[model samples]
Target: LGRWINPDPGGTIDGLNLFRMVSNNPLTLRDRSGLRGSGYIYVPFLSRDTVDIAIALYTQKYAVNKKPDIVVFSSRNEQLDFYEELKKRRSDFAAAMGKSLFEKYNTSDLSRKSLLNAGVKETEIKSTIMSIGNYLAINSMTLMNQQDDEIFSEISIGDKLKIIGHGSAGSAEISSGGLKSVTLSMHELAERLDFSGLPDQALQITLLPCQSGDELLEPVFIEGKSPFMRTRPSAAESLFYEMQARGYRRVTTAGYRGFGQIRGFLESTGSHHTQRKPNSITASDDIVRRRDAKEIFC
Candidate 1:
């Protein structure tokens, strides 16, 4: 809705060219503030392309796959929950690793040396670690995605399982069904994703087109009640509101429950050992949800 944001009507009516799309390439215009139109206006956003390379990678992977596929119904809930739980379970995981390989991982402090003691390869641990408040900033973007199916499209129910997680090691070899423990390095995860038929360029311009007469790809995203811990990205909600304002119908929602879609996705892929489906219901929007940003932030 760039056109809707056009405050000035002085432009020509023969299809106004008010907001020119800056070439997706990098530009120095943002650093140079002379381009700022007025005290209330700035062009920093023009330099940042809204395209999502992650989604593009998925679409590219989908295009290259030639084999028959079993499209599953699990949403992205399980993995999201796993990640959230991981943050809480880090110490536990470290303890487990330490018991397996001591001295190298426990360096008398929770440091990079701890990972080394835990038998984590040098590359698995980040070269540098930084923390802000309660959040520990890592060296990778992570294995997060729209759904677990997006990552495991190459595997099936009865195939030999080769799985990966942000932390763990060794491909587990067992009977027909058992949870394996193999950790994933950040760089390794990105590399594996590249090999998974996901185009590397998808990270920059992952686009999905509309049926027709629509300018942008629109998706319906059902979100959880907690804003701070939402499975879907923040942009999805903004787009939903923008589409709503544009009179679009058919709002997109996840599986039945608010936070259950992610959980379902995990259970579908054996990510969660005690996987259980979420229970949800159809409901109308709450008008007061928008009054305060804090209402959703947490």
Candidate 2:
């Protein structure tokens, strides 16, 4: 299932408008801006398991047509939930830590002396306290979404689909029956992905946890001759590595961004620049350029 958006007069596409336009589709439709020369093309999936299946199908379909066949799995909903949970967990942890510190050190203020007296090493206190956030973030990412089990069970071995998500490293201990699995931290993921020298085609399954909204936690994507390569690890990159290590192939991952961030990326790449003769370009053409810019960045 698919839908196409024509550029508006200004060459900019309203994502909200495109979303409204495609509401009739029964499948969950994600819009990509730069494909087919610019407004947006909706990739509709009947279910989560079909996401990779559809992408693989489209990748082959576009490759056959001699177009740049790219598939991006954007974790907008996942990331948003993560961000909200992080904030709540951080606040709760802060309160709990403060209470613990006060009970142990006889003062509410956090300080080296207080932490040390409370039997917490000064060097580790900050991280130890914030670890709750990390724990919550990982679990949130790993938890299966609605109908995930049913969908996953339906996947055939020939299609080679893998589901990537976050969970306790201990979760791997549970029987996967015949399903393959691995677990790693973000840091470990970065090191392994770089050392593995794995081919893109080999990444058939991807399970991404909710990513940190903190810019510092996000991975860096270096857009050069090879646009999709990661130059550095982000909090979410580790999940990518875990997916690879576990042995599912044909993986595609993309970062989640709000509208403002998306616009900023576009501006940085000069996508916002008006065409030489603005009047000559249709609205759809301009929207296509913006979408194309996003595709390049992704």
Candidate 3:
């Protein structure tokens, strides 16, 4: 029953160590009396503790994340004949990060007196604690083209779109030149775009099996697509609606049910992977959307 998480945007770390869910409004912090009142500025004095965390700020006001030039994550179990649950979650996050790095060095020998007692300076605490210990090896990838279902992400298929509104992609790879490069790259990307990157229609969902158009080269299917009795919207919702109908702003890709995508992921309630949703059985244009997150463009 703990919370306050908020990290993992691109992931690096800042808000974690949860046990949240508090708000009765008494969580105060305000003071500003200037003029004839002489002077006052105080601020934030929230209190509540049977075991309250009450820390609105002051871990040096956090701001140190960004370490992913590229980290697709994958130990390879694309779920075809599996590696038994990614080898049991990579051996349980590597034995709970080696028992929390041996109780975090039992006492402390990080040298330079715990990096000036945490004020950090000793040459940036060995590159800031090995860069937040790299999210314990940022490992979690599963798309080896699932033996030809369909997926070929490199990103880029912009400039010709008719105006968002359509969907279809299926297979598990029996191959026909990977279904002619997934219908010759979606009919040369059924509309075209590439309007200056940043999420300008982030397309690339190819996994061939043959028939509609044939021509291949491996990747008939793997972890990208194959077993679809129904539902779809996984290529991050057609790369966020072909980059928000060609506008090029910020939020690059996020569709399948809006604001922050994939229902803002927060699972782990005994973790069996439910709560996903997003394939709303037909009726097109996301008929009012919901089942997760949305907003491929507008």
Candidate 4:
């Protein structure tokens, strides 16, 4: 395959594959909502470059003042690997310990007092539970520090974290493997990430995925009857809500409900159902939190 230069190369996000769509493995990898084409199949959206989108975000949101603390270009393979390994570890831990105990450790505080009260030792708990940063570093494909296993053992991600990946309404799709592929749920991700070290009202997390900001209508079944009416937060919203529930306050999370795309230097502000109109530059963080036709920040 012939290589192509990205049209909008200003402040391109990462050094990996700056000019390739689907990581130049167009035959296998699936790029959804974030990119335009794979091989000869030219989709009629915007640029098929995730780097372009990330650059737009950076130019508009974080780079104006200081560079983002952590920028994660989460590839499908790495996401899948992390999800699979995390899932395996969860299952294995649950098996070794009881399901209830595992749930308590993950849900309840792992503080010394809490662990002691629960008849668990801090040393044993830490030994059994693998550090998430270590897993991410070991499995990362893009830029990641191999020594983060120790660097982030007790610390949370710094102020800002930007993740660009294939997303859906409810989860970050980790694979192009469709149903057989793994997915990381919003709640699971929120629970797994370390957020305890962030200063009050300082953490900012941005997620670029299709309809990741759209809310869901969960039917409230009553006596197994009809006319059940209820609504719930979208995946991104749930992530924020989960963070709040876990005592992280004043943290901002950004996501998009539309099929987010970029044309040249501007982000496509058009809604999901209609053709994108790139008339103005809308920064990802500046997007208004809405159910449709815009971005959501919570």
Number of the top-ranking candidate, with lDDT as the measure: 4
Instruction: List the candidate numbers ranked by TM-score, top first.
Output: 4, 2, 3, 1
- Model 4 scores what on Cα lDDT? 0.42
Displacement of the residue 128 alpha carbon in candidate 2, Å: 51
Q: What are the per-residue Cα lDDT tens digits for candidate 2 across 181-279?
A: 433444454343334333333122322222211122224457575434333343334445455555633443332111111122111224432211122
Show the colliding residue pairs in model 4.
36-48
Better of 1 and 2 by TM-score: 2
RMSD per model, one decimal: 22.7, 20.4, 22.6, 22.5
Q: Rank the candidates by lDDT, best first.
A: 4, 2, 3, 1
Q: Work out the TM-score per prediction.
A: 0.18, 0.21, 0.19, 0.40
* Candidate 4 TM-score, true structure as reference: 0.40
Candidate 1 residue runs with Cα over 4 Å from true position: 1-76, 84-88, 94-298
Candidate 2 lDDT at 243 equals 51
Q: How many clashes does each candidate structure show, in the order listed?
A: 19, 20, 41, 1
Error of 2 at 132 (Å): 41
User: What lDDT tens digits, residue by residue, belong to model 3 across residues 173-248?
Assistant: 2111212221223222323334212232322222111111111123344586684333333333444444445554
Model 3 lDDT-worst window of ten: 50-59
Better of 2 and 4 by TM-score: 4
Q: Which stretches in model 4 have alpha-carbon errors above 4 Å?
A: 1-70, 73-142, 146-159, 170-180, 195-200, 218-224, 265-298
